[model samples]
Target: MKPFLSIITATFNNEKTLEETINSILNQKYTDFEYIIVDGKSTDNTTAIIKKYEPIFKQKNISFKWISEIDTGIYNAWNKGLKIATGNWISFLGSDDVYLDNALDKYVKKIIEEKNADFVYSKVKLINNNKEVIYIVSDTWKWNQFKRYMKIAHVGAFHNRKYFDTYGIFDESYKISGDYELLLRAKSCLKTTFINEFTAEMKDGGVSNKNVFKAFKEVKKAKINTAGISTIVAFFDFYFSLFKYYLSTFVKKLIK
Candidate 1:
């Protein structure tokens, strides 16, 4: 029987936290899934970390495959994962992210119940480098909101493979906002539903957050090209999110 889900991760040199990411997937109580890892030829201990889990995956009867090679970027590595993924639904996870304790159990159940929905999204827990829960990002969003912001956290969103066959893979040119662009493209042709669950824990300071200027630039371009949101609206949303983040931090400091 084919796997019901595939969890794909694109990593460069995330040796420190990659183990937790892999272990979370392997420990899923819901067993009908495959895990794929795409590495970007990390010079660090990333590959060694992967090798360490090889026997564990086999002994546990988990279907797993991974490859480390030079790739253009995260989006390109994800595209490679898509090409080889054979799951009915595929979810993307970063090397520094981990699923909640019952993430797979909930997602698998939701997927089966909401079989017709093309996309599934859930809220996420954001943890800082200090391993503290800084925020929970599950602001309710309508499907029509994709034109403005990335309402769907890619770490907690699952895409039905059929959408990939129809709408296509992540645009490799975008280093930061390709996933958001893909969500925009899917809005036109897919049915979306949300599960009221906290699905994953995203370690803060991701690639997108680190490259703020470039991320916003690509998001603006994606909005204009993919979703047809005006440049003005896109710019507003970008700045609005920035302001919100800083304001929240400032407020936190005041409270402290």
Candidate 2:
């Protein structure tokens, strides 16, 4: 049987781009997947948008489940989706992100071809606020060097659901780097694969890029906890990342 994927999306007041995200999932060539959307009581047109698409999804016999309620944070909302998701494998999409055509079909093909990989990931195309392509980074990553940085993008990544019980859920306390923390914590236990094509297109202004210092702090803590590093070492990594983050952000602003 083809693998069933649970594509989870967490949204909050993202009326402008939610439509694109939802449409990307709905238009997938590979349809053996369920979409689990956890909304944080969006006080905008987000709920209306989801409601409008409900009948369409139902007509197609798609498993589309969503809930809008109060959540502590994005990762908390993600945990809710994870708890209710029933797919054999899972992937996440941001409210402002989109999957390229044939992303899931390629993912399924990868699964069939590479039987041992616990998770698979692909390349990502980053776009600025005006929808201009910024740069595409190589998705090829080594888990051993993860303590240096997150070489993978979440939107382009798929996870095997069976490992959730083994590694635990996203840390609700983490504001920006929860996914990184989860991946790092789960790295030693899971076998991962890197696909060769671009899977997702992402808008540049995610939480981590905007709040570099806070992200740095959370990532440092997560690295220390998961990698068994000394606080002193994590501290050095944090400051080094801090400098690089600010320098990159500054260069981008100058170019803009």
lDDT of 1 by residue, 138-254 (tens): 766575665787766678578888888888999988988898888788665658777788989999774434587678788888988888887788788778877786687689789
Residue range with the least summed lDDT across 10 consecutive positions in model 2: 204-213
Candidate 2 Cα lDDT to native = 0.85
Model 2's C-alpha root-mean-square deviation from the true structure amounts to 1.7
Model 2, range 1-256, lDDT digits (tens) per residue? Answer: 6888899999999999999999988888888889988999999999999999999889888999999999999899999999999987888899999999999999999987766676788888999888888878665667667766777767847887766767888888898888888877766665888788988899987556557778888889888888677799899989998888789879979999
Q: Top model by lDDT, which number?
A: 2
lDDT, candidates in the order shown:
0.84, 0.85
How do all models score by TM-score? Answer: 0.90, 0.94
Query: Which sections of candidate 2 miss by over 4 Å?
Result: 187-189, 206-210, 253-256
Clashing pairs in 1: none
List residue ranges in candidate 1 displaced over 4 A: 1-3, 206-210, 238-256
User: Residue 65 error for model 1, in Å?
Assistant: 0.6
The superposed Cα distance between candidate 2 and the true structure at residue 238, in angstroms, equals 0.7
Candidate 1 has an lDDT of 0.84
Clashes of 2: 0
